[model samples]
Target: MSDSSTLPPARLRPEAELARDALSAPVLARAARLARWADAGTRVDAGGGLVEEQLPAAAEQLGLSGDDAAAHASEAWRIAVDTGLVEITDEETGTVAAGEDLALLTGGSPQDVLGVWLTALEAVLADASVPDLDDLVDAMAEGGEVDLSSLDWDPEAESDFLDGVLGNLYLLTVGEEGPGEAPVPLPALAASVIVPSDMGEPSNEVLEQVSDAMMRLDDQFRLLEPVGLVEYQPVDEALMADADEEPAAPVDEADVTRYGMVRLTPLGLYGLRARLLDAGFEAPAVGDLSDKGADALLDGTAPFPPAAAHAETELWLAGRSPLDAARELLAAARGTDPGAPLRRLRCQQALSLVGAEAEPALREVLDDAELGGLARVWLTEHGARDVPPPPQEMVFWLTIDTVAAQLAAEGNSEELRALVEGLARQHSGFFDTVWRVEHPATPEVLEAMGRLHPDKKVAKEARKAAFKARSQQGG
Candidate 1:
């Protein structure tokens, strides 16, 4: 994935809810239990791993059973150590004690608990990137020290690959056009990072690579599920064959689960967003602007998806009196900057959520040049009696402002094209009157209409009008 600064915002669950999830995740819960269970009597190896003799006892403590029970206990112990749930009191003596952070699980704020969980997640991610124990043992059997080349695992590359996969998963979960909470097919996800975006058809070699990535991800997600990062359906066991051979093509739709399917849990979204922010990514969440001023709310949510923006604005408005919020929003919306049109658009959307109590604030702005048209429209829509019609200049100015806002927000979208066509068709001479509007975005809006309007002659009229507006502005 590219630098995460460009990633879309993730709508995360509340911190308190996610903190509860972190505490209940199988891996984290076991790790916490083991942390509480450990005492001065507990012993660790030089590496701070639970001593070999204690593995069975630890598994029993976690009530874990099966062939993988001991391995699970060991993984939990490692997490306990890595996240400071258990401290290595004496490295030389391999003595262990409950760590300071162990107290945070019960006493700290939700953010503090989540911070510990993030640390544990990072440790798990590092462990997931490592080659299998069997592979490691085979490599070491030759001379005791493992040969990395023999294992064919580049630690950095493996780590980066997992990060890329997780990043792609994050995108799928949060992108406006993504699958949202629906489980992504494993084959599709593996291909996302393997197949070139510009490539029309994947080569045979590329397909093989994708297949290999799927198997690796199957293992990784299995490990990750215990940590509450993903809800995963593992690749079907029947599908596994010789590692060297490729399976047949065209997996049936019904058999998609045979390859695997995965979705990030809500907790996973919180965890990944935290990681992205730590890496200097500008990852925004819905309520991030709740405590901020109206100007921040309008400017900040300008780039958000409609639903996210509404959710954010709703939260921002929830704290203040509707009248106060309306006044603040109206004051912030009055600007001549390039971004001001979208700010006004956002303000209008936010005002729709305000009750009739904000009528006074709207009435106060009804005569202001920049705000009068929207105020009149809002008052009329709310059934305020005797709301006067906006003057022709105000109507045309608002039209230019609205079109400019749409262009900035949607970028010549299908809806905008339809809008441009409708505007030209509805008015006898739209371009002729629109060019004379005093709005700062008049020329730009006209130019966009010239490009978006499908009628050739109407499009020419819009371009001519835009040129006239530019010349008038220069004069």
Candidate 2:
């Protein structure tokens, strides 16, 4: 459902605090460590599942009972699998191994490790059961809550509502309300998220609905607790029952509002914070004109969105020498990927700022194949006398530039592949001709095209071409 309210402001945090919390949170990282330890000491069963005895170690590691041991191990394994920390090639028979990303995650900076974990969490709703969970959470995020009556309340919608409440639980944890910072009470969360104005006070049906909502809320938290994203306390006795047992007894002992609190762990807070940033929440942009030179400023602003970069560049280019600006710009442009047309255009804008003064630097690179095309274009536009026609290499680079610009602007991957194929078909020696062009990005472009190509055969040829190009550059 759509709503007009804006998302809550994301609190700006220091790099030190983010890294410290991520390192201290320790649950997912602990799970990763255990996965590695298990691979060495414990044997995998024939079915590729961990041996039963290993469950005790995993459970004890986390301070759970033997009854909770196996489930705990299974949940950790699922987390490991989902986050690419563990790879089981064949679920039924193949041996488990630590995944490629495992080392990068474990050994990398805490900031990066938390980022990887959050990325996995972001995709947690990909299962068929909760496909629209992210969308529901997004709706609720507006003003930090949506009206309960406004939502569809059928069986599927009830399920979504449950997930949405759990998402809100994370939001509430990070939000400061009186600063005690414990898990938010279930009823309090419900009251904030759900507005039931139409339902009269204290009807039997209303009470039952509220009771069920609490139970569902508790059950969802229990399920998530094993994944290390939350700490849910005052366990509702109803959830301790086996799946085969009679359905959980309705709330009887105390008020439904009295218990069942959930809160985000430190890592969970950071994860949600990252999501807020991804959803267009602004954070402080540092490394501006104060310390960085034109070269550093150009490099720093190069990767930003066009409008933001343009604004930043306009400020940065002020009070700088035009000739020096041109030199820095051309130097920066030389380092950009051939396949990144947008970067080249930004380079063009920076180049244009230099006017006639940049001609001296442009002359130096005019005969250089990789940079020559840009130089030629810039010089011709400035009314330089009788510049040579762009060579085969420049034409090839420009073609790649055009396709990249189209892809970045329109994002049609299918059309990108088709465009690449058409160019390849037009010249059987396309790869060979481009390989010797001496442009800094020639090899990079060929390799990137290989990855982007839909057809395996073409991709393989593109890769081979890239390898050849690199070797030519080396020779």
Top of the candidates by lDDT: 1
Q: Superposing every Cα of model 2 onto the true structure, what RMSD results?
A: 19.7
Instruction: Give per-residue CA lDDT, model 1, range 1-475, as digits (tens).
Output: 4454556668888889999999999888999999999988899999889999999999999999999999889989999999999999899999999999999999999999999999989988988999899989888845578889999999999998998899899989998899999999989999999999999988988988998898899899998998899999998777667666645334588888788899999999999988888878888987889999999999998888898898899999999999999999999999989999999999999999999999999999989999998999899889999898888899899889999999889898999999888888888977888898888898899999999888899999999999999988994
TM-scores of the candidates are: 0.95, 0.43
Model 2, 1-475: lDDT tens digits are 1233233322334655655554444446555765575564455566455667777777676666757567757556566666777777655554677877678654777667766567456434323233244556755736778544444535467556755674466445533342224767665555444537575555665555565565556656665554445677744565546655322223554554246667776555556555545655432142244255655665555445445455566666665677777777666665445434555666776776667877888877888655688888889989988788887767887766655554554465676778878878888778767766655656766776787777898889889988998888883
Candidate 1 ranges beyond 4 A from true positions: 1-6, 141-145, 246-250
RMSD to the true structure for each prediction, in A, is 2.0, 19.7
By TM-score, who's the top model here? 1
- Alpha-carbon lDDT of model 2: 0.60
Off by over 4 Å in 2: 1-5, 12-16, 19-27, 40-48, 51-65, 89-92, 119-159, 167-183, 191-202, 225-228, 235-257, 273-475
Residue pairs in clash, model 1: none
Scanning candidate 1 in windows of ten residues, the lowest lDDT window is 242-251
